[model samples]
Target: MLTLRMFIQKSDVISFKNMEDLYSRLNISKNLKDEFKSLISELNDYLDRYSPLTINSHEMRFEKLSTSEPNPDQLTNRELMDIYLYGDYAHLDSSKRVRFERIAQNNLFAPMGNHVFVTIVNKLVEIIDRAVEMNKQAIEQLKDQI
Candidate 1:
């Protein structure tokens, strides 16, 4: 039996695009698909709420703001999610860690804080677990028929 821990330990950084590829390869069910979409939408909403000033500004202001470069370490929630999903958290630079800590301290973001990020990751891992379980069941059934 595949436990969540085992599954996560075996996983690599799966980009958003790559997740779609995995879904195709696994032939994931509609329920799982909808759940994945909902999780993604929630992540998007969080990102929109906490989006950096540059990306959140008005179009007219963009031209002027465009001249000034945004801090590469000033990541959106989505970017942070990507990092958590695929990147080595332990290896993250001090700057990125500080930036993430700042976001965790934000009044608006504090309510959900790190929990939301963890929840999304856990949900994705659950999907993978379910897929593996389903595959095992199918294999066993096939064996029974033979």
Candidate 2:
């Protein structure tokens, strides 16, 4: 995740965030573009599903956020990065640490959050892998033509 934060995320977000603009700049074949479009759509969906934004973190709960709520799962992809960056991995920001600690101290978030965090993270990794592979193949094909 650190590597993602430092290096890959910059490019990863750009490549997928606005596919129409990026696609307009590319010289990919029709079939390849279609495939890329589908992949990008799915990738973006998962990316949206899992974000680093912490706005909704306050609503997260172990079993459920509220008894009246339908899903109860408030965990977002955005909140996971905080746990890794502030709570566990870097552990630098005092303010973030406090927030993360409060969230972590929750009876349910401590254990179940780990499981949920890892599962979604793995899915993100798999999507990123596919995007990287496709980009590499496209670039290599372009190189061959040159």
Candidate 3:
């Protein structure tokens, strides 16, 4: 008997696009065509990367803002000028947004301070959610076959 190990391989990114593409090429089923394509699009969007800003509350007048741990760093003058930083940077002005986008694309700034670390954490969460969704959809499809 083939072991479960035989069914799965390492290095699988487990995106909807990969799954749909693989099954469609094999001509899995007519009923699954539309649903599979839609799932692939959703999965692709979830996996797509978006740089976001992270914020930690320092000492605040409000009790809600109080935190025992403080963020490690803040942006430097040079970093603030970069465009990529705007991906996560929140500003009312479009000009500032453009500047940050330039900074990020240039890779001119390093992730500094508590806010940057928070942004990293947030991105990690998004990654996990996408992975989970992809795996779940794949598993459900497998179950239908069995």
Candidate 4:
């Protein structure tokens, strides 16, 4: 899980769609708009099996922010990073360590099929890229104004 965390830290975001949606719904930041699109693309690519970003941490945890609801909980860019930057599914269960190891060793995301695994990888990458992009743009803009 710690490895995953580091992977996410080094990984970059380039989309602001989710960020913009959050802002529009919550009035957080209007500046993340343009960067969000690029982020989404970047994430989509990063999470792919061929991408350089991969899990490496042994101790990662996902912090539950709110009670489950019909609408997903709102996530800031940093919070979003927490999700992908953490452990893989089996990390949640110690009993599954052996099973998880098998999959990990084989580099197979799923035993039944690779499609679902691919989809998840893509999703995580997409989300991370989007958030990273928005955050990057905001930092750049701040630097420019200074």
Q: How much lDDT does each candidate structure score?
A: 0.47, 0.58, 0.40, 0.42
Against the hidden true structure, what lDDT does model 4 obtain? 0.42
Q: Lowest-lDDT window of 10 residues in candidate 4?
A: 47-56
List model 3 lDDT by residue over 8-119, tens digit each.
Answer: 2123444334555575764344555665566545434432322233222332111222234323323322233222333354323476565444334443233333344345
Candidate 4: segments with Cα more than 4 A from true spot: 1-93, 98-110
Predicted structure with the largest lDDT when compared to the true one: 2
Model 2 alpha-carbon miss at residue 94, Å: 5.6
Measured with C-alpha atoms, the lDDT of residue 142 in candidate 2 is: 75
Indicate whether candidate 1 or candidate 3 has the larger TM-score.
Answer: 1
> Per-residue lDDT for 8-123 in model 1, tens only?
33253444344544544554466555655554455346543322421222111112223355544344445655444333354555655655555455666544445656755665
Per-residue CA lDDT of candidate 2, range 1-146, in tens? 66545322444445455544565567766666677778767755654453322324446443333334334234455556555566666636776676667667777556655665676667767766876777786787678778
**Could you tell me which residue pairs clash in candidate 2?**
51-77, 51-78, 52-78
Better candidate by lDDT, 2 or 4: 2
TM-score of 2: 0.61
For candidate 3, the 10 contiguous residues with the lowest summed lDDT are 1-10
Worst 10 residues of 1 by lDDT: 54-63
TM-score of each: 0.38, 0.61, 0.28, 0.34
Summed over model 1, clashes come to 1
